[model samples]
Target: MSTHFEERSGVILCRTSWGSWYQTMEEVFIEVNVPHGTSGKEVRCNLGSKHIELHVKGQEIFKGKLFGTTVSDEGTWTLEDKCLIRIVLMKTNREAGNCWASLLEGQYCADAWVQDQMQRKLTLERFHRENPGFDFSGAEISGNFAGGGPDFSNLQK
Candidate 1:
């Protein structure tokens, strides 16, 4: 959570000395930078249900537990541009609003945008509680309401 992350198109991204990683609600994508002429044969990547180990040219790039469980058998990796190792990991949990706080456990945290989104949801829920008959679950509050809060005029009840 070193304030070195950004959110783009709903994907949270973080960069490290080795490379970068981004995640959607359903999957985590990692890109590791290797030597310019590195080949797939020089890469060693192991995907476990709760851990991952990646090595390039016999050098350990990363090896640690993941932030969340993933379907290891469905995970895949490939060497692109002869210098980049791209990996795709499918999450075991795909419930709505489910998102990883980071790629690795206790590592980089979610971007501020994600935190803001969560805050907005909490604010909406508070408004809903104060104004019954109005359903705010999953509601996206954008712009300003007439009373400077959630518009309850269109209450369900």
Candidate 2:
């Protein structure tokens, strides 16, 4: 059967200006694909120099070096029921390009990382191919509500 996941290298929806790629707020996003049953404590993302290491139980699950700007300190993640980790990486003016253009450039990831992802996609495709009567589950990749953003405005007396 067809699963809910998409075979994506990386999908970066930049909130840029219409005229030019101007991000009013210095921010970007990172979407991580987590397995069906993953706990919040089990997942860890160490961000440094546009590189990220996803670890579960102190073991690296996914390792890839992003080609975009450095991941800002300000960001949030939502882990949905299906176990998709959506991380919104806050960006800064210091970094260069946004996420969308960056990930497309090179294969800056490990073979295991690439193989694991490809296998997942292939498995789904195979299931559909084999089962003629199979239908999609329509399972959406969602996340839990962590917290709100920082208050930029001044407090009233």
lDDT of 1 by residue, 55-111 (tens): 898998988999889999999999999988999998897532345666788765557
- Model 1 Cα shift for residue 16 (angstroms): 1.8
Assess candidate 2 and give its TM-score to the true structure. 0.41
Give every collision pair in model 1. none
Candidate lDDT (C-alpha), each: 0.68, 0.42
Report the C-alpha displacement of residue 102, candidate 2, in angstroms.
Answer: 2.8
Top model by TM-score, which number?
A: 1
Best-fitting candidate, scored by lDDT: 1
Name the 10 consecutive residues with the lowest summed lDDT in model 2.
Answer: 16-25
Alpha carbon lDDT at 90, candidate 1: 88
